[model samples]
Target: MERERVNRKIAAIFAADVAGYSRLMGMDEEGTLARLKAHRRELVDPKIVEYYGRIVKTTGDGMLVEFPSVVDAVRCAVEVQRGMVERNAEVPQGTRIEFRVGITVGDIIIEGGDIFGDRVNVAARLEQLAEPGGICVSGRVQEDTQGRLEIAFEDAGERQLKNIARPVRVYRVRPSAAAATARPALTLPEKPSAAVLPFQNMSGDPEQEYFADGMVEEIITALSRFKSLFVIARNSSFTYKGKAVDIKQVGRELGVRYVLEGSVRKAANRVRITGQLIDATTGAHLWADRFDGALEDIFDLQDRVATSVVGAIAPKLEQAEIERSERKPIGNLDAYDCYLRGMASLYQWSKESNDEALRLLYRSIELDPAFVSAYGAAAWCYVWRKTQGWVANSAQDKIEAIRLARRAVELGKDDAAALSAGGITFAHIAGDLDGGAAFIERALVLNPNLAGAWLNSGWVRVWLGEPEVAIEHLARAMRLSPLDPILFRMQGAMASAHLFAGHYDEASAWAEKALRENPNLQQGLRVAAASHALAGRLEEAQKAVARIRQLDPDFRISNMQDRLPAVLRPQDFARYAEGLRKAGLPG
Candidate 1:
């Protein structure tokens, strides 16, 4: 006999899951299982019952439920998630038991007290699209729950669902705290302005999430190197992290005209990165591209991705910047003076000068902590010390470097000087390669005329595996500061960039220029030796090595990581080490 079809009615579906269920299980079976049961008993079950929700079924790591009202469902979801945040206060990010929630209001078949329909399916899909500690809901659910609930929703646009009939419009639910502390909508910049939104880590492994962030940060720094864009600070842009964000809303919040977004996926030593530039005002795509490479070749991959994005946007941004500069007035004199004084000390490029520069910077910050340039210069002092091999205490220096860089980025969101300096140190000292790049780029966007930002940006680009772009940026820095007292530093960096790119002759030429000003410069001597050795100029390479030995008779290729601040990538460092070995550096 044929069974009667069940009647259909409107229902609110909620989907919930542990952020990293498999990972949690892999890390600890009995403990994870115990925690899940304890959470369900203490929190999840109580909320479901209180909100008039019916538990349809339970998967070991997730649950599906039907609520009588969308309001009840959303409220319960938010509370449960918020409770988790408080529950995880003492827990580290690496192993937190965060929950992602997805709610939808839709039609469902009522059969034997179990619901079956696309509404339930949509909720599941939205959950998949949510950030680890966030929530996602369908448009209808957001609409029905609006005004009825005190929650804020961000339009995530249409997402293609697996095994679904059509694209679904999803919105991300912002945490209550984020909404409470939200900045007043900003005034758009007169010039071209942009914010590189944090890249999505499409890689399922939570450990690789930082890789994606680092990539975005590099791109932001790269784009900032261009003098024409008003770039928002990394901290501001990151406010949207783990939230489903509307592009237009991001523009309004950040006061930027353009927005760049992307994703990174890594698996089995291979990585695929994809990015798109958008006209935030029009919701139109300006540019898009994908980069694929071996994971070990990550530095090169990041450079190519960043270079392409920068090349695509330069013309448009330049036009906007000129327009804005015409409308904007100059900076404050006292603050500017203090910043310049700090710069004077920085340019001296010795330990005593670095110390003096730091003192001047501290006074500048005291006078006006808003002077982002001073913060950048201060952070650079630490980087300089590390590069010159003068830091006697690595651990304490690293801690201080990170603390200062974090503060510079926090307080100097609109300042290019602050971002670049802080961003570079974050990489070298804190090992936050992605974050450092982002801040540096933001600085470039704020004040492209800042020659030092370009100089430091060039150095990081080489570390990120874009020696070609590094050379270009350094060249621009030299042009901007034709007679700069620190001109030798620029020339030496250029030499290293060329050496990194395997352009031996160009490396040799730039190194010679650097040596002309500071004959004892260790960086210039090292690059000249390495490039000459690799290019088969054995006599010249040996001569360069002899000079290097004169400066530091204890130098050896074996201690390359400790000695060479520029070698962040293993392959590049190994290649340079080999060249040093060939040039007869001991060990």
Candidate 2:
């Protein structure tokens, strides 16, 4: 006869242990055990029962508890810590006892009165990872307990626990001291800075990797609405592909302070997403969460994930306010899917990719005309064509770009992409410098988190002969899109702005920085040549100009209007032209 196995519906399993338990026991085994018993009897047991938690068992130094709700587990954990803190305050420093606790919500098996499963194993591991006297919970528990407690939680990111089959997302409830420390550090930046990394694909389908990648790009686009955040561009972050990296390293490499990483998994009709934020300097987990829903409800999932992420970083983020900002087109999930596909193509940055991107963007818009991002992207394609001189019909291309950009603005007046692309088109092709600058400014004011708006607006300011202002905006753009492939553009814009403002030394320095990243950056070359000339370094100016001519044989200052955007004020144009002439560009 086979032995009978008991099954029970397990909601959450909590495991806790004292840090340095062995050391304490070794020093005074009987005394330690006696104190542990006293503490359990006087504080821990009562609090667990108060929270409606069941104490499954207790070792000499640890305890295992089960709860029907994750909230109960966390509340009990907080109470345990608060009680311990007060108790320790009265004891000597050397004799003070501290406990590390971990909680997870998962299915488990019950044998007799003891619970056993991977869930229990995971909680044990998390407890070990927790700092002494701190509480760490899995992503599931964090979501389950959110808004049900008064304490704030910080994301610890995903950790590959010992013997675990997969990485676990973890969160640490901000300890009282940590929370107090954070309050005084809440000095807002003149411009906010952010980073978006590739979202993980949990679906176990290798082919769906592109879909996950597309989702991240879409998020970058969406968040690029706020002009205040210095958004790290996608290319910069994607460079770390396929590598197991620390978020702190990412922050350092990208030169941003905050890092966002997440994973996406989809199966049939269900989808699951996990995300976390980390402070780069301290390697501290700032926030972590998991969102699971039906595949048909992906839009809601994305919005919720974005909202949660923003709220984690900026506690003041209000759901009601974000919901009222704008809404995407409804009834066309396929179109939205296609738009994501198009974004993947656009990120490739080659002519072949651009062509494919155009096709997909147009197809998406055809499916849903109100998909404003698609229209904005289509307009960008034309801008790319004009910049690369790849257009077979410049007149027709500009006309189409202008039309698409205008339509994007009309449909997405509140969207960052629409305002950004429209402003770029108007400034570059339509020669509406002031109007374009104002539009970009409006986009930034409307969405302080939008990186693109700041970047484009910085360029607009440069064109308007306000290099000082341009540099300020461009620096903020760099902060927002630290990983952006087009970061060279921002650097080049800064150099050009400095050059136009007659800050030759600063221009040379910034141009060199840009050149270090991309040796063949045309704008950097132009600015470097001008800076060298203005600073009376004729030899370096000639060398830079030579490189420019080699790269573009027909390069000339006067004809630059045809090759570049026409958003420049007269003063700005003259300043650049004089620099080029001084740098020995042929008339």
Q: For this target, which candidate reaches the highest lDDT against the unseen true structure?
A: 2
Off by over 4 Å in 1: 1-340, 366-371
Tell me the lDDT of model 1 at 10: 91
Global lDDT scores for all candidate models? 0.77, 0.78
TM-score (C-alpha) between model 2 and the true structure: 0.62
Candidate 2 on 1-587: residue-level lDDT in tens? 99876696776888998888888888888898889888888888988987789889988688999999888889889868876876677587766679999999899998888898899999999999888889999998888877767678899999999999999999998744433442121112334456778887888888788778766765665555443445566666777667787776566466567888888888888888888888874588889998899877776777777666666666665666555423444457788878878877876666788889999999999999888888988888887766654566778888888888889889877776688888888887777888888778778777665667887888888887788999899877876555567777788888988887889999988898888877767778888988888799989888998998987787787677766676767776676777789989998
Cα RMSD of all models vs. native, in order, equals 21.1, 17.0
lDDT of 1 by residue, 295-341 (tens): 66665676676666655656545444323322211144355455556
Clashes of each: 7, 32
| Candidate 1, poorest ten consecutive residues by summed lDDT | 321-330
Best model per TM-score? 2
